[model samples]
Target: MKKTRNTQKQDYVIDILTNAKHTMSVEAILKAMPIKVNKTTVYRILERFAEKGKVHFVTGEDGKAYYALCNDCNVKHEMHNHIHFQCKSCKKVTCLPYEIEVPELKDFEVQETQFLMIGICDMCIS
Candidate 1:
C-alpha cells in the first residue's frame, strides 16, 4: 500500500518532530524537510498527528508555534505529558522538564501539554 499526501505528511510530521533535536516552526519544517510539499499539507498532517495523539504542539513565549514528539518512546505516547526544550544557541530541541506526578482531573481528561523552555543549551555553554 502507498501513503497519501496526508499519511506521508503525517508520518513526515512525526519523523521531523522525532528526528529534530529542537522544537521547530512550520517554516523550519518546510525548509529543512526534504518533502516538496506546501503549508496546507503540513497543517493537515499536524492536525492528524494531533488527532491520533502522536505528537504535542505548543506555542513558544515568542508567540511562535512549534511541535515535539511525545518523549515516551518506551511507553504509549498518550501517557507522556512532558514538554520540549529549545536551545537558543544550537537550536537543538530536546525533551526536558521531565515527567512529574500530577493529580488527575475527574471531569475533563488531560491529554497532553507542550511546554517549551528556550535558552542556551549545554552545547552552547562556553
Candidate 2:
C-alpha cells in the first residue's frame, strides 16, 4: 500500500488532537484552531485520519462525535484499545487505561469494539 503524505490541514488537525486535554468535536476543534479552516476540510481530514488509524471518534454523552488522537497509533496499526468514559455532569469524554477483550462467538466475528462508561467524573464528584 502506498503511503499518502498528510496535507497541511491534516497535520494541523493532528496537532490539535495531540495537544487537546480531552476528545473534541469537529466544531470545537475548528474553534480552537489558530488559523481559519473550512468546516468541510476539517471533517475530511478527520475522516482520513480515522481511516488511517491516526485518530478515532467516540460518541459523547452529548450525542456528538468526539475525536481523539490515538496515543501510539500509526499507519500500520491505529487501534489504542482503551475504554472511553464520558462524565454525566460535565459531558467530558476521557480515555481510560482499562482494556477489555471481547469474547469471540462460535459463529460470529468481532471486528472492533467500542466500549464506553458514563458516570460522574472525578472533578464532578468533588
Candidate 3:
C-alpha cells in the first residue's frame, strides 16, 4: 500500500484526535484546530484516515458522526467489535475497552458491528 504524505493541517488534525482520547465531531475538531482549516479539508482528511485504517467513525445518539483513532486497524482490514459508550448528560462519546464476541450465524456473514451503550458516565454519576 502506498503511504500518502501528510500535510501540516493533517498532522494537526491527527494531533487533536490523539490528544482527545475520545470521539469528536467535525465541528469540535475544527474548533480544536489552532490554525484556520475549512470544513471540507477536515472531512477529506478524515476520509483519508478512515481509508488508511487510522481512524473510525460512529453515529452518535444525536445523529451526528463522531470520529476517533483506531486501536488495532490496518489498511487490509478494519474490524471494530468493541463497545462505545455515550453519556446522556454530557453527550460525550468514548470508545470502550471491552470487546464483545460476534455471534455466528448459519447463513450470514457479519462484516461489521457497533455496540453502543447509552448511560451516565463516571463524571456525571459523581
41-80 in candidate 1: lDDT tens per residue?
Answer: 8877776776776766677666767766655455446555
Candidate 3 global TM-score: 0.84
In model 2, the clashing pairs are none
Q: Which candidate is the best by lDDT?
A: 3
Q: Tell me the tens digit of each residue's lDDT in model 2 across 1-126.
A: 644444666777888999999888999999987778888888889888787778888877677888988775432333346789998898888877787655658998655556678999999999
- Write down the TM-score for model 1: 0.69
Per-residue lDDT tens digits for candidate 3, residues 5-121, read 448888988899999968999999999999888999999999999887788887889998899988555323355767889999999999888877777789997766667889999
| Candidate 1 clashing pairs, residues 3+ apart or interchain | 21-93, 22-92, 22-93
When sorted by lDDT, best at the front, the candidate numbers are 3, 2, 1
After superposing candidate 3 on the true structure, give the runs of residues whose Cα lies further than 4 Å from its correct spot. Answer: 1-6, 72-77, 104-109
Ranking by TM-score: 3, 2, 1
Clashes of 1: 3
TM-score of each: 0.69, 0.82, 0.84
- Which portions of model 1 show Cα errors greater than 4 Å? 71-80, 90-92, 105-112
Candidate 1 local Cα displacement, residue 112, angstroms: 4.3
When summed lDDT is taken over every stretch of 10 residues in candidate 2, the lowest stretch is: 72-81
